[model samples]
Target: MPVAGALTPIDWVTRFDELSARRDRLGAVELDELGLAAWFLGRAAESERAWDDAHRAYLAASDPDAAIRCAFWLGYTLGERGEAVRARAWMSRLFELCGSEPDARAGAIAMLCRSVGAFATGRLDDAAEFAERAVALARASGDTDTEVLATMNRGRALVFGGRSEEGFAYMDRVMLAISSGTVSDRVAGPAYCAVVASCLDRWDVERARVWTRDLSAWCDAQRGLEPFRGECSVHRATVLRLGGEWGEAETTLVDVCSRERRPETLENALYWLGDLHRLAGRTADAEAAYRRAAELGREVQPGLALLRRDAGRLGAARTGVARALGATPLTGVRADLLAAQVELEVDHGDLGVARRAADELRALADTIDTVYLAAQADRAAALVAIATDAPEQALTLLRRSWGAWRRLDAPYEAAITRMHLGRACRTLGDEEAAQLEFDAARTVLTTLGAIPDLARLERLAAGPDRTPAAGGLTRREVEVLRLIASGRSNRDIAHELFLSEHTVARHVSNILAKLALPNRASATAFAFEHGLTQPA
Candidate 1:
């Protein structure tokens, strides 16, 4: 038996079982409780029905305020469930009930709904304005739920609009309210999840890690809280992965992937699972997971590209990452895509494109001001420096990046940085320093089973001359293959490589023949499949 207002959805659901037989006797208040309990328990259809019933009950009882509340939840939840038309109908009903100029509480909820709609459609300014108005109205009406939720919405809008520090301050206030029990369980649950999600979207891993733990605890304490549990697990798995707890992250993701019914939640879990598998060099498993996530409408970008790269499909990796970056508009998401672009371009020996990408990533990192994004930017810049004969610059950047990764407790990323540090040191003629970095990186990669990276490190140590060409292609043939994969014609290749068109055509023919590819397209595919973007 929980206290009156501290929600225990399981207890209410049990009570619902006994009273459902006599549901006709239940009034608006009782029906409202049942609706909330049903929603928290993941019974969406039942929850909607009960909320509808409660709305009608409130109407019959001549309580327009209460009815408006029910309609708001119905509209919001319906929108979330992808029933946009039905959601609009409910919102229409709410507005009709409001009758042009409603009282403070009802108007606050209406404003909150508007804010949600605006945020969903990428109207950040409108969303923030509506949320601010909602907060003001809710505070005036003494509606803590509306005020807290509106504050969260405003924070998200601010963050997405690239005002990261201000947005986080607002979100921090909301969390403080939740921690102090100034908000109800219903409001607190979503607020906790939303703020943590915003932190993740901005690459504020430390903040997200902290809030996710708190959210998990909140869900656990609620016993039968179901709607938020899946999202909580997804956030937790992300934190685990970032902290280098890959095994635990995999377990959590696999469990959520199997059990979560929500498409978005399940998609995230599967994507993260793919990322984990990719790091471990389980290419087949990673591909399957990424494919499933894509089927669920997830844009599996940087992870998929990195997977292709690890599998030695450098041409395909670069093309995929470039496409993803072009389509993505969100700054935080673009930071990730740009980082991948930098890595791919560097590997393809396109130093100019890589440098531009690194510059963009550094700009984004400065704007976001998060340690994670900062480290990513540093690592990207270091890669470009390493490729362009700037070992001193690369070493400086790598040191900062390695320290950041260490502070973040991300062992795999730190190890990768160490490998790059070794390259920079060796380039600077510090053989002793290079050896130490290589040894440390090798040990960590071996412990983590990072097979692809370990193999790359071994090849690096063995020197460029020792590396073998893919598909028996000669160095010049591989170079021609790379140009072909980039959509370059024989004329372009001839112009770029200072050869006759006939000579370029001959090289292309040799490339296709060596790789057993039927035509230029197949040749391109082979180039991608075997990572023959550049000669060894």
Candidate 2:
């Protein structure tokens, strides 16, 4: 009963059922319609079967071009479903069918499929080469849809191949095409998702924000567009979370998960929801979200490790992060894991482990040449310096990190580095500068509603200044006193502050004598009572 040219998925389903009841043989078009309906419904096996049948029907009709198109979609869907071997086999069949004398449009489609295969296998250079060829061939054949896809593919390949500027340039062009309505509706959704993903992967937050806004506007203007809406919503939520809008981010991701029909989209939304919950200190909720994400086949990493660290399971946290770092190759995600490793190792007082992680982060930053990674590396190094009692060196590193974060417009990260800088300044006996930094950081953290960071800052800022000078002791004696109160031995204190053990002993004696304390324990108690042992 459906019109020939206006069949919805429901109409197609109804038609297919009626045809089956009448024992009618379905042709290429019918099979293709069924496949599309099954795909839209997230029925992967059924969709694959329908598409395979459509491909054979097209071949039987001697429509090699239509069959090749079906092959491309089948291969693409298979790849997305993680059936890489079958995907490659379908792509290989397409290549064989096309042979050497294919038309320009067929050649372009074949190259596009090859590019996807190369990208899947991590041969970025080959992918770029194939995508470029596709673009040229499609343009010559006036195939705008293929050209658009090829352009996006080429951009991603170039980005992964370390030509990010050029890659983003191509991506920007594709975005222009999409905005101008030059791209086909079929290509627009995937193109937008690809560009946004590339921007996020490269730590190009500003670009991601711009593209996400554009995508939101585009989605708003369209009615009933489903394929990319969930992905766009996720990207929008990520931008919100990064901008310190945690409540809105939580709401957005929850909405996305509720409406997402695809397993991949639902999994991604749930993972981000877990991240938001964890950040807001909703431990049980975070665990539930993470569990659901895991059930959907998402690997909950660095976030899970951080949750363990927060729960006082330092050993488990250490093992989880170490395993994650070992398994992950060098990439943006690896940089994030390394950053967490540095923080965890520093807290565990494993300065050597922290230093190694920091070194690797610095190397990764240099390789990627991204400002965000550079800032993270500097912050990690600064934390290690602080843990090792090199406050002056820590101050320098923290300043660099603060500046980098500021340049990137990352307010939360900038504020964190400022707080560390304040501590470093306090350690160096510059109370005036320390107070200024603390006040500034407090304002930012409060505005962002970063509860844990604010709480830590409150703890650090609680104690009144009780320097050795005020207690009839020198600054060096005050430094030694605090370390002693922290349970460091004389040798440990000496090593930490880069002092000789004899000098440290002399400082200890001076502190004991001045305070009229009989022993180190009493001195430590005095330090605590006077608040000298509070974090600098």
Candidate 3:
């Protein structure tokens, strides 16, 4: 067998496989090295087998401390693979071993493992308590690996418990230590991933961007760092997607999915691939990718609903998003679902549902205090206001939404908000302001190569120019006239169009004055004469 120090992780895996085939006996140390090689190669089953062998070997050799270490690694790998019950069982064995041996390092590792299991099961208080004990024990034993793991768990618990700022601050300190090389390579990668996950969970994109940079640098410094490199690539790809570099992001995600062996990493990359394809108007490709992601046990949500909306299946989109929102509680993903619900409900002309969704989104944003969620809430509110003929209120909300999106450096969303702002301004008779907003939005959409959005915006901007010259009636007035000609009352028109009855009345009076008609019957005759009424 090759000496562990003489071979790289990949080389060791090959050598170990050869040795296994030859039926060569491995010492406890060699078995542990084999496990490490399997882990670095992303072969979880192989890693677990090697670790189990090493644990048995160490116990037979009367090395309780070595056995405990093996148990900890086995537990960590199982937990990462989402086998929580198996992971907890291994951790319990570690605890029992530590009890007999009374070693501080073993006790700390046991506590950290238990804490992780507790956190996974949603016992945040128990997680925090166990993590604290682990940190204390690790510090006393001078075990930096255990200390870092315990600290990360504690920070995660705090973040999930609603102390985001404090949790992030603590995690930042840990990241700083990793960046400074104070933490070992064994712990650095996991720490970086944990912090990135926490930032993503909280919708702290700016922080995620910063840490992704650091993670990329760290990965570059280590040659052939298999599993961590795949994870770092995932994080960088997410940041790229958020920065509007869709092509690059898609390439990166595809590469990661091709190279990564872990189901979780592959699942996330596939989901992101679907998002990029959907955003680029490739519906078939997006659907295929979403299906693959779902097969990997990922939830295909907001993206799938938005894709259906883009395909003009608004009813299916509404049903899908509404079902998702109804089943999910208020959380980060719920925020995204609610945003999709608002747009779908509004487009379906269910203004009451849209208004309720907006209100709920606003309340959730206020409770979470995330800039992204707040911006989404503002956008939803603006759409509801515009539908209700409250142009002034819509304008205020759109501006707030636009500012937030701009500050978040999300150009596409900012451009969408600007388009809405333009419509609000036009409704309020501010033609110059409306034109400027439209121009700005057009530039962004063009630069981003957002073909569908640009096409939609062009159609909206052309509506006024297409107005019939008989009496200079607006598009909305024409719509109201058509509904009048259909033998619909004002209340019926308001209900169908998602407008207030008062707004419908005002549109009727405007239609009468513009067409120089005396009443609804005359306006109906004019509409039919102008060929504005639908054919039987």
Candidate 4:
């Protein structure tokens, strides 16, 4: 074939296929290359077959070291595909071969496998120990591939064990090695994915954004490569979304969702699609994306609940979010769910439940200590404080959250936090401060095209009591206008407001006159149009 790294994966695959068709039997090294080529082209079955054949050939030729490498790859690929039993069998075979050879490279691979197992089973201490042993063995053997993999594993374990700084340090070094070409091609793909995934899991958006760019470039260099391409697209889309490039983010997510074969990667793309659609106020599209992700066994939460709330289905939103928080354990975006729960409960006027969720979120933020989590925790606490009439406390938290969101370059979140700040300022009678905050938030939301948030801000700025009294109509007249929109007659309004029929009739006339409406029907339409009423 071509010399190593001279041809793209596509070119390598074409040459390998031509040779395989012409030859009676390909050599073990050829088969190994074919396996990697097939994997890069998303041909999982072909890759497995080639690797298995190569493993058998290596054994037949008494090359146990090469055979052990093949076995490690087979186990790794199978485990990634969720074929746990088959993966375990291969790993077991790898260990058995290592027992006979007793070499440092083989020992390193075996230790890495053990670390993976322990981590999967939640034995963080054991996982960390095994990963360190693997690292030591790989270093002794001068196996850069095993060293990178083992270091990434140790870092991941440390992150999971609540030592995020140490874990990321290890992961960062591994990434540097990968960037410097110390890592082999086979190890490079997995290494890039591992470090980026860890960065995203911790909500280190800045790190994720930078690494995702590197990953995209790396993927682009290897034409026909599919294993890590989906993840790269998903991560790039996230960075784009956070940076307010909604159109491009949507395009990337849609492309990945349509093409990605891996269920987990596709699920992530779909979930992000839902969130982007929801923020853009495309309710039906968001629901469809979320439903598809849920079908693929993704926990499409917080975003789905927020969608319900945006549609004015507050009860459904509260119920769904509460159920999600109750069912989900404290891991893997649980902090996001808790933050949503706190906000939903606050909006539903359940201050006690909101406070509990806020407390949990605060604790999670303290433990995670990431910018995103900290911002979410502060905002959730601010919402609870606002509901409980602790305006000063809410203001303090909102400023912190606002600064964090601004630092993260998340215009949408920053604007939303400013809206909270406005509310707190209004509650404390700082009218000028409140007005400035509201005006700033409105400008950002208007620019972002965040329809629901923009609408809410409009209502907040409508009147002193957050009542929408347009066209110079008094608050009492606005109330009458809303009732009229609900199809309430003058007599019904009179009874509800404990006023005389003449007084209620007078208020209705004044509302129509102030709004320059010809009749009650026009008045009703005007009320709904101006945020004084909503559809049932």
Candidate 5:
């Protein structure tokens, strides 16, 4: 529930409505920043003269796109105010200027300029096409800024297209690039951070922390970056949760959620709260947070995949994660990448599916200059390789991902991929290599205090080399060793005695050490000979 202090929805709507309708005509050609902002927000207090003033200044600016962008925004303001025909005429003028332009990114800019018109009236497909064309043009020109814009636009289309993976990848590239120090686009770093922060739902917290660290530092250094401060705070909270700093994480999220005005912001914060709770093993609290996020996400991105995922766990419906969605298409790298995700090579039921996905993503290297997206492409390809049981291919992709993640200082992702790499190697019978990778990953997980994961790694590493010590076992250890001899899984032991799996594992280790048993076989023989299952 929103605090009583929060502004009512009706009040905001009423204020904005009044602002949009109260335009005066004086100095309508030379609008300043304030004037343009009011016009953009449809505020009633703005005068037509503000738009005029802004238009004049835009014309006076050195950049050609500046004048054209002003023309479109002014036209949009007019259109929103019921001057559709006049707005269309202005848009036509902007399009004309987009052609034969001298700027290196003029083609991309032109494409995007055209897409905005399509997007204005909810012609999402048309907007996607234009944006896609813009991305292609931008990439062709080798302009990283244009590429970033194209990727963001493309990501929007991909999301609308029911290709969440593709949309996520494109946006990830833009965000990763920005956070990793390659923010070459019209969208400012802090602004895009909001978008990135909004995407944390259901993502692995450790993996997310890698990007959040850099993002947090950048947000601190930048001023006038308040638009996304709420989100940044939420991200920090998530990292703290992943690091096992539970109290701080919980406090931060609760505060952020309370203070946030937008449904989107609050919803995102709530979603992360759910994640934090779940990671801490608080099933009930996790469920509540997930329910809230699902309810809120339904309003914006209808049938959100992440919601569907949570709904599944919380006994909610399978409504959101549809196999097929009636989505509008996207243009450029966004579309290409999204298409690639929905068409995961796994569905093809062959090794070629993974290869195709990889190929599709690889084709985008020239389209966007964000290393983050490139890493995703590699990781996606690696996943495909794993599905196809191709260890070599998986290794190659993992290696690429590692390199990119290192440059981005994304240790969590690196650690995750390294774990996968170890698995791939283990499957290929390279235990020595597997053990080393597992050990490295274990160290990182331990620093982050992921006890369960650390224990699992320890177990995996202990699989090949150890034997029980030669000695008599203590009574408690003897009982645990007897269970181990019976071929019981950790789950079975935990259930039988109501002890935690971690505790059971510890007992088993103690037993092995006490009896000097070299292996499970010796422990089993010793237990059978002594009738170790009998009560003392």
Candidate 6:
């Protein structure tokens, strides 16, 4: 095990110099506290794999200070690399180890690192708690760097949870700290640009363009930040994706996925790849990537459930969603926010219960003003709009939802929001506007090869004014097929979609023809297989 205790001044300085040397190779066995700390902090400046290894070694060394250093960097590395499980584990460990007393330097840094990791992995509640802890510790010690980092993490988590204005304040503070020369984050942790891009993407194109320009300059200014090169690409890809550069976005994802370093980063690339594919009408490929990303995100329920839902594997998504919602280690606004996501899926599938769930989410949001949850609640409300047949209402909700999601630099969710907005346009009888929106969405999703979403959009591009995801099936056909697949009689089918038995028979015939099934039995089987119907 690595040792974290203090060392003689000369030996420590020499060891630290060796660890910090750009080209020197130091043996892990010879690592001391200062050496390990130097390596943990500077190794990432050397290489990706080396960075994580150093961080882990530092964490396991058992010196409170060394362990604390390791905890911080390791958490960020794990989260950045997409190892949410390991990241969460380290974060939890840090939380337990820190206890109530504030150790200022080590404690503040460790808590900030943990919170940042949590935020990255979709654990906003935990992120908020850790951020607050870090902030308190930083304030107690007057550690400006830790304070800024913690504030940034809190802002990010809040943005994801839907407390945008508050989150923006944090971002503003981060900027202020930067101006105050107190905004140093180890290993380029301060390089996240997606948030700024998303926040300004909708308001003024010139402003966003200029911000991105400055981002390029800032990235270049930080010469030793090469370890975050892939992350930088991810941020740029997000900006391009939001700016409507679909081809560029696809290219960027391909580049990110091809880098072949860090599991978390790979998972992120795959998630976006899957999303882009879905929007682009490439269902088959999208399904494949989504499956892998979901597996990677298995430690966190939200990521797993969203991927499953995108793939239309509802049973699996539902189970994950239910487990996530039912599992109670969560508190404050994050719980309400996550619950809203599950409820939205439930509401989307079960039209009868959508409104109640939306109402529940709204009421919950009223209790806490967090960034991540508020946006989640808005998404749920949009689902309700679709369920209630108010496309305009859904569009309005999507517009708001898009604003929140964009602020967090979460492109995957942003794509979905855009698609929903297009659906609203279709419902409002503006086929041209809908087509543009769908095309924009398709461009993003095509890169990911999202299957079901692609299939729905393809159906829309070729059909009349209808929600792309609802496919080309008319309302009546959707209803009749639902019942027929449920083993309902012709009479039952007619009653369900609201038509005469003769009309229902005609719908059945058309469905069989449309699906190119040879017989009613085949058509019925198809309906069940395609989720157009439920078992009786």
The Cα local distance difference test for each model comes to: 0.84, 0.80, 0.80, 0.84, 0.57, 0.60
Q: Write the per-residue lDDT of candidate 5 for residues 243-354, one digit (tens) a residue.
A: 5566687898988777776565688688777755554445577668777876885221222333323333322222221222224322222423333342233433344644
Give me the displacement of residue 194 in model 5, in angstroms. Answer: 10
**Cα-based lDDT at residue 322, candidate 2:** 88
- 10 residues in a row with least lDDT, candidate 2: 1-10
TM-score between candidate 1 and the true structure = 0.84
lDDT of 2 at 216: 80
Taking the tens digit of each residue's C-alpha lDDT, what string does model 6 give over 17-51?
Answer: 55557434543333333333343334533333444
Q: By TM-score, is 1 or 2 better?
A: 1
In the range 430-503, model 3's lDDT, one tens digit per residue, is: 65787788899999888877776887788767654345543555566667778899999999999988788988
Every model's TM-score: 0.84, 0.79, 0.83, 0.84, 0.45, 0.50
Off by over 4 Å in 6: 1-143, 150-168, 179-182, 185-217, 222-226, 295-349, 356-536
lDDT for model 4 comes to: 0.84
Which residue runs does candidate 4 get wrong by more than 4 Å?
Answer: 1-12, 15-19, 329-332, 464-536
> Model 3 misses residue 242 by how many Å?
1.2
The alpha-carbon root-mean-square deviation between model 5 and the true structure, to one decimal in Å, is 12.9
In model 5, where do residues sit more than 4 Å from their true spots? 1-115, 119-256, 272-286, 298-370, 380-389, 450-536
Error of 2 at 34 (Å): 8.2
lDDT (Cα, tens digit) per residue for candidate 2, span 313-400:
8898888888878787447678888899998898784779899999999987776677788899999999988776567789888999
After superposition, the stretches of candidate 3 with alpha carbons farther than 4 Å from their true spots are 1-34, 53-66, 100-103, 464-466, 469-536
- Distance from true position, residue 2, model 3, in Å? 21
